[model samples]
Target: MKFSRLLAVLALAAGLSGTGASGAGAAERVRVGILKFGTVAWEMDVVRANKLDAANGVAVETVDLASPDAARIAFQAGEVDTIVSDVLWAARLRAEGKPVVYVPFSAAEGSVMVASGAPIRSVGDLKAKKIGVAGGPLDKGWLLLQAYAKKTAGLDLAREAEPVYGAPPLLQQKLESGELDAALIYWNFAARLEAKGFRELVSVEGAARGLGAEGQVALIGYVFRQDFADAHPDLVKGFVAASRAAKALLAGQDAEWTRIRPIMRADDDATFAALKRRFVEGVPSRPIAEEARDAAGLYAQIAAIGGERLVGPAKTLPDGTYWQGK
Candidate 1:
């Protein structure tokens, strides 16, 4: 009888221990997705350096994509919990009934136009010329570029010229071959083009400022499905914290480029240094009024180009929607 009682006690202890361990395990592991962009590199560095994800039991895995369209498709198929993409793209997804929400202010305005051989001087100079764009008409970068053109030179891009569609790498090659005049390239890739003898036609910083007519406004941020966010509130908050830490480190002029450079890309010091210096002055701490204004301005440009209304989020996000480390 004594032996039987001891065995029963052992069984009960084991059951309790097993239940506790299971609960703990469930609380610790969270799967997240990220892109292979420099923006994500900074955030990943924060996660690893601060040990934030591990401490919170979060396991973050980035899903690499070759194109924006691919990233959108993956997010829609439930392959990723979150993504680092433009606010407009997220807005478009939400409009398509996917219900993704922009993660407040989480972006660096890294979109810019580069002119090959200094032929294009300003955003307006591209009139009657062919411009290379990755996505077709109504592309996010194209829309923003249109807004800049309108604000800077009073030239409406919708009536100006044609946009040639091709991916950045292909477009860069086209520019190099003189097959294309100029291209709307992301800042990271645009910097590479500059290294290869391309010149900056315009920076999103100038465009953002010209369009908003106030503080800086640019499209950049983190986004996630609403259902995922509702299901993982703590996880969302932790992710936001990690993003803030990353941005803070990158925002510093004295940031350890030696550490960050390799993570961004295996580029030479000149390119990395130039890219880092460019972003140091103008990166936003949070998506605030300016982001909303910029979003509104971009939508207007898109509507003008398409001659139809766009199905997306609010014209301007509310002030509280974009805040740092929120």
Candidate 2:
């Protein structure tokens, strides 16, 4: 009788151990690196606030960094599984054999904004005017604008306009203060200016279209190390799904804005509304897919305009740059 009791106890212990092991195996954790003010912050915040990751059967840990560069460093050091960044950066990394893959996060791009009362009615009107260009002269948006001007307006903005390089806020200030007649600014800033009656000379999408690229050329995306993605495909899918769900909520409901409004810290109702509109406009309309041909065409255009400095010498999109799922 004593021997039988000991056997039963050992069997029960083995079953519990197996159950615990299975549970541990089922709950995989994924770590994502994000910047405090980066584009992905709002969506990631939604995911965490609602425990979306847990609902999706994965444990997500968000590591907030000070800036984009800090996020990049953390990702490179294997401290985080994924980071929010531009697709072009992912292409550059893949070109350097970094084994990184890009997943579409946002499709919104900046635009060229002119003062409401300014005489700049078209891209051609930018001639001989002070144009505030963000991210310097070689910025992708500036380069695309340059290409658009040369292609559509039959003039070179580089030679015609006095390109004033500054941050987006400074550019906006200069435009408002009558120092800059026009400014190429991000969508959010452009939206704010539009709300205040500024005229949008050209959108990045419009510029790209004029340059012959088709469809929405996604500028921003989430990049992950290929090894990590391969090791935990479900976790990656879960993250993307959670992010997409958050985006849907933002797109469909005005109530969702209240949750993220604190993070935005808008000074007034008008600014908040404008920012919200811009944010909703930026959400991808379709599921994220690998648009290799479109990406390749846009890359060619960028390479032609920016040369070795912006997109490197390859002038072509790298293989495995887009995550096609498991």
Candidate 3:
């Protein structure tokens, strides 16, 4: 199994696909691009462990890549059938005349992490302090923070905080090393930091709620091109069912966690527990229509601050962005 996964990674990196897109059979393979250490792989592990794919009449393959960029590249090159991305990207793609569709994955978002004893208590306290931000200047979480601050605190975090942008790991390290006053990082990294005694000053989810977004917004999801879905509609729908089943297993059973702990790379029991709890907390439970409504609202809030370059070409979410389980 290990050898095969390694080969899959190599094939993904080389833009080679072992699966065919011919869609002549229900068992025709469906390859999903995954980041090697991403949380998405955890759910995929659950799916395989439970044989959910076989139950749903789909043959699933996972292509591991070193980074999100690599995963997107592999997917775009037709080396993988789907990638776990966000509705924002799908909206952007639709605006560009490519009709990508989204399947609800997780509402899990990032947070602002400060030292446990750091003086910063709210967005207002971030003024003139150095902040380590992941996902660059146009990151949705960072932009949401800015919008939330402007609406509630009458301050723009992007302008007030000395913005230091880097990858999630780099930001995590800097926050731990005291080189940063606060770090806005993805949820998994935030979970690790929280386990290490870092404090969450503000969560992106809380900020979105403060901005009047309804329901739990599934910010990220399994995204694929519509043309690809047309090729294997059953496979696509089956993958969704398999994903839902996997989420149910992960959310309800501790037994599954015991099996997948090693893949999580958690250094301590606290980290392991944190990752498990946060991941389950992110499971999408709201109806797709409700989540889509919230996502559209959240998009406008971020776009008002992030503009076209960050929010993408769509001024609003394009129609048919959500798969709606059809």
Candidate 4:
């Protein structure tokens, strides 16, 4: 009888231990840093609202930051396991031996906007005009514009246009008030301008191709420490799955836009609808591996534009920079 009792006790302990482990696994959380007005905000918000992380067997907590620099600071301080940033920044970080890897997130969606009735009708007409540039003078959009102009029109925009650097919101305001002739604004800001009767002169994707990158290059992605991804491969896969699911949801359902419209803070219904359309248009349809070659080419284009400051001295896309196999 004692032997039988010992066997039963062993079985019960095993069951209890298994239950404990499952519970712990379910509770494991990953913190991600994001900027308030970045491209990642929409998808991250969708993931949180729909409980996609929980469904995928992981928990994610998003930290809202004020600026891109703040997000970098939070990541460096170990307050966040991942951040939503561009591939160029990820390449720079990995080049510096930071053990960073990028998971493809959003397609390039910025464009140069001009007043509907403005005299500037072509890229060549932008010469000698006041151009408002977002994310500062060395921003990717500005650099791409410079390259596009020099390559296509044989004009140097940097020497021709009076480049005024400022935040996206401020640039948009200046453009509306006629303080600038044209502005190379971000995706959302460009969408808002379109709603207000502004027109796109050229999209970032077109500009990139004009500067020698392959078709539809992905510019932004989710970045994380290599150690964190290695330790929790399941979490990384789950996160990617959840993100893709969110992208799919946004793609098929107009109702999903309603859920995220509040976060966009659009000034009007037209602006909101335009922003939603622009955002959905930029969602990636395939994994990063499928676009590895194009991504490498895009990286080279960005390096050429910004030189050492943007991509460091490497001037090349570092190996293992693109996350493969989920």
User: Which numbered prediction scores highest in lDDT against the true structure?
Assistant: 3
lDDT of each: 0.58, 0.74, 0.80, 0.75
Local accuracy of candidate 3 as per-residue lDDT tens digits, 1-326: 00001101111233543322222244656788887667888877777767666555556667777788888887778778789987777788878887888988888899999999999998889989999999998888888888888889898776676999999999999999999999999999999999999999999999999998876787889998889777667667777777777788888889999899989999799999888888888988887788888888888877777788865677887888988654
Residue lDDT tens for model 2, 109-163: 8989987777789999889998998878777788888888998989799998899
What candidate 4 gets wrong by more than 4 Å, as runs, is: 1-25
The residue pairs found clashing in candidate 4 are none
Q: What is the TM-score of each candidate against the true structure?
A: 0.75, 0.87, 0.91, 0.89
Model 3 residue-pair collision total: 0
- The 10-residue segment of model 3 with minimum total lDDT is 1-10
Better of 2 and 3 by lDDT: 3
Expressed as tens digits, the lDDT of each residue in 1-326 for candidate 1 is 00000000000112111111122233433333444564565656555555544555544444455555666675676665565676666666655566666754433453545555555776777888778886667566677678778766887776787778777789878878877777777666777776666787776655656665365554666676777666666666666655554556666535555666767774686678666765555456434554566666655565555443443554533233332223
Model 4 per-residue lDDT tens digits across residues 216-290:
667788887888777777667777777777788888888888878777888799898888788777877654665
Q: After superposition, how far is residue 3 of candidate 2 from its true place, in Å?
A: 54
Q: Could you say which candidate leads in TM-score?
A: 3
Predicted candidate 4, C-alpha RMSD? 9.2
Please state the error at residue 177 of candidate 4 in Å: 1.1
